[model samples]
Target: MLKITHNTISEYLSNRTFSSIEKIQKENNNKKYLLLLSFLLLLFIVVQFLPWTQNIQAKGEIVSRFPDQGPQTVQTIIGGRIEKWYVKEGDQIKKGDTLVFLSEVKSEYFDPNLIQRTQEQLNAKDLSIGAYENKVSAIENQARALEQALIIKKNQTQNKLVQAKNKIEIENAELQNINKNNQIAQNQYQRIRSLYQKGLKTLSELQEKELKYQETLAKVSIQQNKLNNAQNEYYNLELELSAIERDYSEKIAKANSDKQSALSQSLEGRAESAKLRSSVSNYSQRQKMYYVTAPQDGYVSSLISTGIGQTLKEGEEIARIVPDKNNIVAQFKLSPQDIPLVSKEGKVRMRFDGWPSLVISGWPETSTGVFEGHVIAIDQFLTSDGYYRVLVQPNDKYKPWPIELRMGTGTQGFFLLKTVPVWYEIWRQLNGFPADYYREDSPETKKK
Candidate 1:
């Protein structure tokens, strides 16, 4: 066991066993080689200490910041060949702008598997609706009959009420006649009584007068009873009229309820039929209005399946539309290794293709016409290409990109990662290091 002090190591290197190394050094220590070697070492050390903000450069494009409902993909309504193109790509169009026309297609002439099946189904549905129409008509007729019967019953009730009034009036007249005869008999009895007392009238005559008065009184009592009976019968007739009214009302209500149920059923059938009819009508109209129109005001961003004579199947995509100006965003793609370094704090330097600009790495002062942007968000997952899609917005501190900046223009982004010793990043990249700049415990990771 031995402890090798610094002096001991130096002395060992100076020994004759290391004399071969010493000799080689002495022979090759020419002034030019020594000078060149010293200069390279100095340069490497200086570069390692220089302020190097890691800049991740990725080729990207200027993309529109379309709203949730902005961009749309137009598709063909039927299987047909393109007859003509009314507008080309990059054309600014208003809503309902004609883009391309498709040739006419019908079930009889052009019967694809899907189109033929759909047409047959529509025909079957139309036929099925006839039964519902019959049901509706039958229900309506029943309702009408009930309504007419109710009217007739009401008229009969009114007639009965009038008859009861007439009977009451006749009975009242008979009662008055009986009352007049009773008064006349009372007067005759008085006169006869006076004469008999004077012996000028016979006893039989007086008795006869008394009997006549009694008969008249009896007739009055009988007639009064008849009047009371007639009045009771009149009330009873009124009750009958009320009962008839209630009975008819219930019948009419029931009939109306049944009719409504039938009508609702009919309407349900008709609603579905209307939907199918509209679909068929739209297809027919589309045959004449063959041109596919834009759903919104926008520029024709791109055309994929649109050309004269190109066949388009039903619902096949034709082109992509970029909605109106004002919403613009820059999309920068970054490698997984650079993901940890890209966040809200990261800076973006973009050069829109049409806008002439030069990005001077690490020297922002020398950059020319470059649009400055900031990282708004970074996708949580890598795309199919193993790159993260980073959303960028124009930096408020610097000048914004021109309003004329078009979507899908070529762009070069300089995503400024954290500033570190230039040598640290160089060494990490050389060794194929993973992203480790942002820690899980940091605010950035927690926020995400």
Candidate 2:
């Protein structure tokens, strides 16, 4: 009985020792797992505090930074039929290079020598204007000659009037003298008769005095007639002077009327000539418009009118030209809610289509195959798609953009904002909050 009790006690001791060893081993294994879990928790906490760049995402396409350097559509100022093509699609051309030749489609411009014919018409009009000008000049000269002739005629008429007045005065003086002689002779004849009656004078003497008295009377009558004739001649000379003035006035009036008519004709001809000149200039310009030329250095992207005889309306688009890709930019569309987060010169990271990229939304520094750019412009108004457009250009401070990039290529852009803790970004994103507002020149940024 004592031996059986001793064996049972030995077995119990051995089992106790084995169970203690297994417990110790299990405790050691649990301690190692606990240490590993603690290390992992500390690592997670540290990562949350790491710096994260807040960014606003956007989608866009590549375009030209300058409007003039963008795509342009070729058009014609006047409608015409395509006569020939100087270039095909995708042809590189310089400014003023002809793309197509057009023929006039309108009946008014159908004549092959339209410009030359218009020019000829203009020349004829000019010649007609010159002839009118010459006629006007001749009429002016005639008016001057008529005026000078009138002055000469008036002077001659005045001189003739003065001569007539002097002749009349001389005749009046002769008549007065004859009358006086007659009176004297009459008195002598009466005295001789009285003497004869008193037998103191001879009859012959009385007869001689009577004869002399008769002669004096005859001379008086002749002188009176001469005075009347002189008066009549003076009156006729006055009438003649009046008639000359009237005749000259009529002639001058007729000349003035003719001159006015010529001047009016000249004015009309000048107006017509001016119209013709304008027509000629317009035709000449139209002739030059027959050849459609490139507005700048570009490649012909497309031809809207392909057929040789296709007719184009006025101001219709003919083809599209893609200007040389000298200054490429990414045009990004941002949400209105995020517009306030972006500003001019804001840093941006772009991933172009067909380029491999790995992006970390909160850690842009670790991103690969992404291009750097800066915000150059932002639209004040919303775009057609209800989003604001943001223009981004290559960052001069960093690497240049890829040369193989083409216009209209799709792109994904992120506008970098304030740096914050990853925990904050995660919290804000969870709460659907916007990025924090901060100026680039803020005191905090400057200090950093």
Candidate 3:
């Protein structure tokens, strides 16, 4: 039952009118403020269209400059105390050169045969074992020569005996001729004497015939004695020659027999020495297992030894060498999201962090141009920062640009992601969608 008087009505209309005016004024002010905000927003959008406004990717050098060069470590063929180092660090070496020396622990690492033979010699306690072997070999050669000489000597002795017999026969023939002449002379003398006695010839003729017969008789006797002496001398010479030759033959035979026996002894000694040497070598080799050696050439980076001369357990990493240049691998990490785009054959560009604008083409330094390379592997484990690692093998055909371009050059890098179209960027802005949406579908289609 509230009364509605004429004044109340009038005042209420006034209040309504006043309130409508305030509302109208607020709306006008708000419209102007909104227009100003729109102007500022448009100005911002226009600025992005200017050429200077764009996001660039990252760039830098590799892990370091001047990668370390080291020689491959040569290990002991059979391990033992580092008996000695033949070449110290920084020493130049040739192929097949012995860089390190290892003294045998117990005289066993020599040739097995050599060691065994040495042991045999030791057992015999004979310093002459080696000398005996040489003597035997020399004697064997001498025996062969002597045998040949003995054969020739025997032939010569037989020839001398035959010549002596021929000389005796000739002397006997000469004596027989003289006896026949003497007989003829005697007959003539006797006939002449008988004629004289019958008075058919003079006394002078008989005397001359007797004188000639006497002279012929004397000549016959002298020739007979000469023949006898020649026969005796020939026989004596033959006997003496036979005796001398027999003595020589016996001496030569004895010498050859002695030589053979000595040679046999020498051969036995050699065989025994060889056996002992082998045993010593085997023992030396068995002891070698306790020793350790470098696998490749490198700088020793770490040593896990308890002290300078402490013994290490088997399989222990007593020391480590920073591997040589060939073993250097460029390691890098990227987010898991980037892994799918990367593969074993993916191409990548690299820059060292320390040296800006310098990209190492996987090529080696010996090449004329930047090297081409391919991805070799990806680490299965992720880093603490949730990044997976990758390994790239430089091309072998070309040398790398320089050590300045290799790993540990402190180089930082970036991989260029595929770019998006200009229209896609504009469309994304119009729809208020995420920038990534443009990667899958056009902004226009996504909005639809």
Candidate 4:
């Protein structure tokens, strides 16, 4: 009986041990399931926070940066049919470079009468200039000749004046002789009269003495007339001298005035000549328009859009130039919300897609080096594609960029956005409004 009881107890003990092992195994399996669930929950929480944590910068709007480009170009000055083209598209040009030749045809609508009138006016100006020149020359010659004659006449008058003075001296001497003779004749007549009174002379002798005295008086009178004539002749010569001197002075003054007038006329002639020369030069340049030359050193591009022998009007477009094909930029699209951040003078930081780790900061560059630029403009109006485009400018100063940035290159780029409060997103969501709707309107509307 003791051996049987021992056997039963041993079996029961073994059973109990087996059951405990099963319970332990079940607990281990449950703990493992719980642990797996906990790990999954933790992973989900971490994944939700990954985007926020990766970029801690305040969330705002993303925008595009538009860059400055080369100067704008146009084609025609005055409307005409293109005769020839000096350069095709993609040709570089300097200032004052000729690009195209235009055939200028006389306007069919122009009035023939007006043309005739202009021609008549030009002919009249020519004739007037010639006539004025001839008149000025003739007046000048006449003045010179008159001046010489006046000088000669003045000298001759001076000599005549001297001769008249000599004649006056001679007449005065003759008058003095006549006066002496008259005085002697008067003494004789007085003595004859006294003798007649004293009966010492006869009547015939007294009469003869009186007649001699009268004759002496007549001679003295003639001498006096001669002296008066000499004086008058001298005075006339002086007057003539004075007149000639006045005339000479006047003629000389006129001659000098004519010289000045002639000089002025010559200046007018020079001005006219210059005007004609300028007109002729302009016409000649127009005629040379038939031949077009390369304005600068550059490669000729295909005339894809515009062709030669095409009629164009004023301010028309003929061709374009790709100064350096190696100069290229990436063009991308942005949302309307990005407009404000990318202003005309705002700075841009760019990085090509698929290479974010290698960021092109401060400025987007084409291969020569990192280039600096500012935002130029933005298209507020949405395009048909619902995406607004942004333009990037490569550094033009660093020409001949690497092969990757050539004109016909494919590039990808991204524009940086301005930062704002993180709560603004929640606010916009709650209000059923866009993130930038408030900014789009005035301050009063923002509050509303």
Best by lDDT: 2
Give the residue spans of candidate 1 off by over 4 A. Answer: 1-45, 56-74, 78-99, 102-288, 293-313, 317-337, 349-373, 382-387, 393-414, 422-448
**lDDT comparing candidate 4 with the true structure:** 0.60
Regions of model 2 farther than 4 Å from truth: 1-22, 108-110, 113-123, 164-246, 270-288, 431-433, 438-448
The candidate that achieves the highest TM-score relative to the unseen native structure: 2
Tens-digit lDDT string for candidate 3 (1-448): 4676545556456635688767987899999999999999988777555332111122222332234443223333443444444344443333344443344444444454654565666667355676776776677666667767767766776776677677667777877887787788888888988899999878999999888888888887887787777777777766766776687667767777777777777767667666666656766565554344455454555433324333333344444345545444456676676665556754444444444354322222222323344467777788887877776555565445455454345433333233444455566658965334232455766777
- Model 3, residue 314: C-alpha shift (Å): 14
TM-score of 2: 0.75
Q: What's the CA error at residue 72 for candidate 2, in Å?
A: 2.6
What ordering of candidates by TM-score runs from best to worst?
2, 4, 1, 3
Question: Which model is ahead, 2 or 4, in terms of lDDT?
Answer: 2
Name the weakest run of 10 consecutive residues (lDDT summed) in model 3: 52-61
Instruction: Quantify all predictions' global Cα lDDT against the true fold.
Output: 0.78, 0.88, 0.56, 0.60
- CA displacement after TM-score superposition, residue 88 of candidate 2 (Å): 3.4
lDDT for residue 124 in candidate 2, whole number 0-100: 84
lDDT winner between 1 and 2, please give it.
Answer: 2
lDDT by residue for model 2 (1-448), tens = 3565434555456644788867887899999999999999999999999999998888899998778988889989999999999999989999999999999888987788876887788788778878877887887788788889888988898898898899999999988888899999999999999999999999899899999999999999999999999899889888988888888788878878887887888788888878888887898889899999999998999998889999999999999999885689999988888998898999999999999999986788899989999988999998788999889999988878889999899999989999999999999999998889866778977777
C-alpha positional error of residue 201 in candidate 2 after TM-score superposition, expressed in Å: 11
What is candidate 3's CA lDDT for residue 45? Answer: 75
